[model samples]
Target: MVESFHEFVVHRSPALCRTAYLLTGDHQLAEDLVQTALARTYRHWRRVRDGNPEAYVRRVMYHQQVSWWRRRRLVERLEAELTERADTDHSEATTLRLSLDAALRQLTPRQRAVIVLRYYEDLTEAQVADALGCTLGTVKRHGHDGLRRLRAVAPELVDATAERSTR
Candidate 1:
């Protein structure tokens, strides 16, 4: 267990940032999400420190992301870094990443959360449902719809022949 909130942030911020970025697809929004989540975690530190504090922070982030989405404040901004072609060797990988990012943006916030939590974070349907405060059926429906949209939008990123996990 982490002894201090600072220690927790130091060790976990990178993973939290990755999850936040996956959820928002925007660095600024991702940063904001993580910061807000961390702040909330700090407030409830005593209550959650003995338990799964990271999970607590993540739950806060997911709920906060949904709240931000509902307020129509999640306006995606294109960073200048995206337009620069500094590395030609990694262009293929970059293309695939951008394609996936675009495809994710096509999903609703809930669907995006479901996909990120299920695949990126590698959570089960039940865990994802619990995290998002929804039913398992809802998670499954969002996961199904989200994947179908991804296939339609970016078939190259998602292999059609790849078998999905039974879980």
Candidate 2:
């Protein structure tokens, strides 16, 4: 537990960046997201420092990513294809990671957030809902839809036979 805002940031920024990267798929955007969230957290540090500051920062990042997605909707850029040489021996895990990244990029912002929170962050449906400031039903809907889409886009990444948990 960090007592100061600076210490909190130093300890949590890497995890925040990873979450932001999972949310945005772009490194620059991820950095900006974490920075924006941290700035907001700093503003309320006096009030939030003694509480769950990391959760507060994550909530801010998720909300900010959604807002940024809305603004970028009209001017979304065409991403360049990932190129791989046949001669280069790539590990299966690396291939899966790349595939998952691409698959995640296809989801809507809310769905992507749901997926990242639920799986990458190991957050439960209730936790995801709280983080996104949404209902549990909304979280469930997005998670279901997102998983369905991921299976369609990258079947190798998501198992076809796995059942969605009711919890």
**Top-TM-score candidate index:** 2
TM-score of each: 0.81, 0.84
- Model 1: lDDT equals 0.84
The RMSD (Cα, Å) of candidate 2 is 4.4
TM-score of candidate 1 on Cα atoms, chains taken together: 0.81
lDDT of 2 by residue, 105-130 (tens): 88998999999999999998998888
lDDT of each: 0.84, 0.85
- Ten contiguous residues minimizing lDDT sum, candidate 1: 158-167
- TM-score, structure 2 vs. true: 0.84
Error of 2 at 55 (Å): 1.6
CA deviation > 4 Å runs, candidate 2: 1-3, 74-89, 159-167
